[model samples]
Target: MPRYLISFEKDAMDHIREEDFPEVTKAASAVCQEAEDAGVFVFSDGLSYDDGDVEHAVVAVDGMVTDGPYPESKELIGGIFVVDVPTREAALEWAAKVAVACRCAQDVRKFRGPAGV
Candidate 1:
């Protein structure tokens, strides 16, 4: 089974009202549940950087550690769902559901397997 990544940009949720988080979470969870029921769920999680609270964020090079992402990205992934499905179309369908549930557009990409395998 091939896995696909389904995610949304962080800025996509910026305009969403804080009070609406509960409803959004509920809706998103339902989609996740549906995926689980279909046996395609690998894993899913949301980033807590919304309030600028990037838990344990750090950068390290040559044993030196710094508190930052070397080069800031204009678009950061807000949440991700990895699903093991048989086809791209199935993955896109899941992404579509995720987009509607999260009230944001979703990005989909297939995962590469072990090198040369």
Candidate 2:
């Protein structure tokens, strides 16, 4: 088994209206529950992107702290699921389910090194 991260960018869900969040949350939660039932889910969470979170992210360089993200990057992980799957194909299949549930595209990548499989 290998661990994979299935995630989406914050902006990827920007097109969704606030009123639709409940439904989207419900659908996404259902998928998470399904994964849990299958014993593939290790963790799942939605990251906060509010002014107090992303806007206030700190970067440290040579012991000096800097505010905000790297100047070259604007995308942020909106949500993620850490799953222990048997193969890349299985990870992709899970990502597909997450994409449909969240109504957005997803990015999947395996954890590096031993992955604690």
Highest TM-score, which number?
2
Backbone clashes in model 1, listed as residue pairs: none
Off by over 4 Å in 2: 54-56, 115-117
Model 1 spans with C-alpha error above 4 angstroms: 50-61
Q: Give the TM-score of candidate 2.
A: 0.87
lDDT of 2 by residue, 11-98 (tens): 8898999999999999999999999999999999988767766555666566766667666787878899889999999999999999
The sequence of per-residue lDDT tens digits that candidate 1 reaches over residues 1-117 is 999999998678777899998999999999999999999999999876645555635555666766444555567788999999999999999999999989999999998977887
Clashes of each: 0, 0
Give me the displacement of residue 114 in model 2, in angstroms.
Answer: 3.8
* Backbone-clash count (model 1): 0
> What is the clash count of model 2?
0
